[model samples]
Target: MINTGKQAQLAQLKDSNAQLLKRLTARESRLNRIGMGIDAASQEAFEAFADGINGIAQGVEKTLRNERDAEAEKLTNEATAARRSSTHTSSDTAIADIMQDVKGCIEEQYLAAEKNLQVLASILGFFVDVDAVLAGCISVKDTQIFIRRSILAELSAFDCIFAAYNKIPNGSQIAVQTAHSRNGVPRDYVEDHYTQRTTKGGLLISEACIIHDEAHGMDHAPGIYTDEQISKWKTIVDAVHARGGLFFNQIIALGRVADPNFLDAQLKGPSNDVYRDREVKEMSVDDIHRFVQHFKQAAVNAMHGASFDGVEIHGANGYLIDQFIQKQTNKRTDEYSAETLKLPKEILDAVVQAIGASKTGVRMSPFSAWQGMRGDYDPVDQFEPWVRHIVSTYKDLAYVHFVDPLAGSSQEDFRKSDYLKKIVRDAGITVVSNSDLTLEMANERASKYGEAVAFGKLFISNPDLPARARNGWPLNEDYDRTSFYGGTEKGYTDYPFYK
Candidate 1:
């Protein structure tokens, strides 16, 4: 931040900063401050972080340079002599130990000062002469690692990753699990889990909820059809709303994929097919008509009864709607089988009619082979028309979330969602791209395609994921995969937050 018009002044400033950094890697460095300094925390860089430091006075610069050089030189000479002594530890080991301390300071606690645009934007592109500053303490390679674990790596990587899209929101998704209580009622702790992840102005899509009793997919999973179900869900919706967040419940019907003994009702799909050794009755035209009505009523129940901001039609992951859309699942010779998209489109029309286009969204996985589902024709040939049709028909559809081929199936090899990037953007609908996206990948997708990316597994352990990403905090990596499904609050709500 020390400004200079001439090369001599700039070189002098970098040298001064290098000396200061060397002092920080010593045994006596402090961690309880906003910026690096050997003594009590200095306001120099923080002021640069606040208002720009356009230029430095020559006399002050000279004084700082001389003091830092003398101190750093003395420390290095003493450290070298100690390394040669049999009674003392090697200087390299000591320096490495101290660097670890500094690294922890950056990773776990450096962002403790405050998080705001004025501060972040100013520091977004900060740089240092890495080799010169960290020369004696660590090698060039290790210095880069230290920087990557620092605040500069987080914000500087993308100048406006958050700033450009502050008003538009991105968020995490809660996948359905069998952890709730009996009768499909959401547990208070589960509701509390959602509340912990909710940030003001962020989007949250709930775990898949059954649309009706016949749509039951898993044991103890929540539903939106019944009075008790809606009331319980309202508790969660109110909490999310209070945090200024938008909550959408994903509504699904398992159809032939449902566990036959558990549904206690007839399993219906486009054909009488065997799934996981259980046979299902082929849906009649009348039966298809009824499920359409069921989906429509469920959407109404979500928005009106439960107060969800919208409903994401679960036409993905080889569920009921997805079954109808895929060629392998819909084998009927009746009118219902003539067009595979008919059932899903009818359901979409009903939901849009009830909830309006702006409050409706759809999630699909045309490339998924989960539950024995795959696309008609080629995968792209099969789903491109469907994507085009949906965006064209429902212009204001809230979003179309797609599980990338890589995340959804094994047979897809390394397929990319390249075909989808433009269609969703051209329609002006927000595209919520999901799957195993790291922080870097999410920012790339967001900038390239104007997407609102969603994270699932990462949020399982890091409850305050948005805050972590905002201030360059490391994500907690100790999630219990065993406890991710049906478990107590240990792995559910006890994940630690970085302070």
Candidate 2:
């Protein structure tokens, strides 16, 4: 009897356990289904909203263009009548009034467009996929057309069209010549594209002043340290700063230090093949010190003269410093070996020692593959050492901006967000995050991180992004794809603004 009771109890317990497991599995499946449904609904709603706004924008754009044409025709007719009548005395007053009216109309139109843009931007701000709408392979001109067609006129006046066009290259043509070869491009081309297009007013708060890589200018021969090159950079920085705009100063190339010899060899290599011709050679501590000294002096000079508001160390994008930090790249057997890699600390120390810690910022693409970068070892191992270095040595630096490796490319190599957040929090340093973030996403991340978030594309379209973001306004879509690199007025200055 006792054996039978024990067996029966055991059987009952097993059955109960099985039933519980089944119930739990069913609950989880239901939850997952609910989540998927929510996501699908959100996507549908966003698409609908975008389509509606775009339709309104197109109509408003058409109306404005027609109105402008009509006004121009009326003015032309009045001018012809004045010429035919030979009534100089009365005609002058009438003509002056007409001119004033035309000016008023232009101003009104500009205001209307600007207002509509802001409102549309605000609506789009609620959606998290603004990056798809704003960045990536799409052309700015196409984006502008999309915005003009989608958003309503009431919201059109709030767009960033005025801001976007102001940054386009104008007047200057891209001339290919030998004189500009010092900067890689022909002298005439440089003069045509850079000199003729840029203006003092335009330089102030222009979108290009923020998003374009500072290193693009460093492509000039003999590197950025040359007197002439440094002088030109100073002029550009000063001009932008004078206009109350922020200029990001590109510091030393981080990965180059891992093999300074390789850099030298590449620079000295055949003129036609520079970026990929030579293999990386080993670098010594002395080499790093020398490079740091040169960069420090340049930064100090720029800062002293109020050339830029701040300087960002190009520590990210698999550059010299990152190369050393990454295990696969830094195969040095000496004290700089992976086990005892102290190069990051040394580099940080040199920079912090030279530039005041408060004025310095470091950019890190912890998992980014830009510039042919591949973090060969486990990302955690590659990143932990650098994070440890940052906590210990450069704690007082302004902020650490991390370029999320998962962004802008199709790669699933790294997804350690939780780990990164924990480390950053423990380190207690201000962290600014970037990578595939839309305005809405950035704001959300900022809310969670309690620090600023950087937006490359939004900054490209909206010169006054900070202000627009704060006011819940719409942003103008970038319209000109071709002009983004080198062009003038058609895509640059033609975007109208709100009054």
Candidate 3:
């Protein structure tokens, strides 16, 4: 006569209604208290509220258990009555069918309640003090405590370490960087580099990505201008994709970093400053516009025709982009002066405009004095405005890669500025930390600071670095320093994978 399943559902509905009333009342109270300040609510009251919610859950479980018992008794009585009558088989079948239906009803009701609870959670999350709401409904704090305890109990507990490349795409937590493989490449050469790296034990994987070494738009270094170069890049991209790896092209304008004597054209820099014994002539606004277009064109070629997944604007290592970013190199009185980050910003914006910001990345070395790009002012103070602007403008970029000053200089004086780490982290962008990072240091920084560590020398030598780190295999220590800058296959792909 009385259906216990429907009764249980009624009881649950009533409980949900009461809980909603209590939650709303508590929210009002909490809101009023929060108006006074966060500390207005006593810890005891918070704990008591949490206990009350727990009690409500326990009461629900008890009520459900009692209803289930009643349903079992009712079914047994019906079967007994059927047995006493002449139609036992018919009655038993009817009771079994009803029981199945009741079970289905209960399950559906439970799912409905779960959905309602989720809706409540999402609503509560809108408030700043949802932690208080959560603490009431919140096993989250408890769960975190449990995790900490469990980690302490375990001998091998570790924090998450992300691979810099995967962090950008939000893929698997492993990455490899294209650092000093070769300065330039021909069509076949590019393909060979990708093939060697993306092979079974090589750096590139479906989970990993590759950043092609800087293409300075100079002689032999590779440029995205021509159809042949575009075709070659497409070949490399397809190869990497076939092997399950993404490829990114890094493009640069060398500025004073390029040798005047070596270049077919005149050397250009931000100011008419002599660098490396070469008299660097000042770049006109037209040159600046042309260079920005160069970056945009490179991005277009890379993403549009070349089939590359993304492009990282080379704004670091004292190149043209870096040259404009610092006061030391940029001496112009125009809008594109050292006081303005117009050049680097424009280059990044142009590239982002060419290939959407999601696929555009930029690398900067605010603290690096390499290639004579250091400014006269304190790096931290001098670069704050530019860093702030970058963070504000291109917040959603694929990543903002940084090369630490520590990579270049070991002087304690150079390490004093904390601005390098703070800049991108404050911007809340995906970061690729570069410059002489070892496997352990990379893991530590990636875990602690939420960064993706980019390895230069190590990735060059250890093709199976992720595997080596994962499996606790010893890394190859010796890499030919002589073959680091420019080389053939000997140092590039000849390094043996861990057996």
Candidate 2 C-alpha error for residue 138, in Å: 39
lDDT of the candidates, in the order given: 0.61, 0.45, 0.56
**Residue-wise lDDT of candidate 1 within 1-499, one digit each (tens)?**
1113333544654565455445433312322221212222223433442222112223334433543454466467767777677466454564444445434433322133223212432332122223332223432212121111111111122211111110001011123432322266676676777788776545678888888877764655577888877888898899977865667788889898887544756877778878787878898787778788989999999999999877889888888888887777888666556264788889999999999776777888766777887734466665776788898898667678887766445544334366664677666556667777777787787656556677777776788887887788998877667766644566767777787
TM-score of every model?
Answer: 0.63, 0.51, 0.60
**Superposition-based RMSD of candidate 3 using all C-alpha atoms, in angstroms:** 11.5
The candidates, ranked best first by TM-score, are 1, 3, 2
Worst 10 residues of 2 by lDDT: 147-156
Name the candidate, 1 or 3, with the larger TM-score value. 1
What is the lDDT for 170 in model 2?
Answer: 31
TM-score of 2: 0.51
Which portions of model 3 show Cα errors greater than 4 Å? 1-189, 199-219, 407-418
TM-score pick, better of 1 and 2? 1
Better of 2 and 3 by lDDT: 3
**lDDT score at residue 269, model 2, on the 0-100 scale:** 11
**Alpha-carbon runs more than 4 Å astray in model 1:** 1-182, 338-340, 375-377, 407-416
Worst 10 residues of 1 by lDDT: 163-172
Worst 10 residues of 3 by lDDT: 145-154
Which rank order by lDDT, best down to worst? 1, 3, 2
> How many residue pairs clash in all the candidates, one count each?
0, 54, 2
lDDT top scorer: 1
What does candidate 2's lDDT look like per residue over 379-449, in tens digits? 67677767776766755565566777665543444357446645664554556566656667766655454
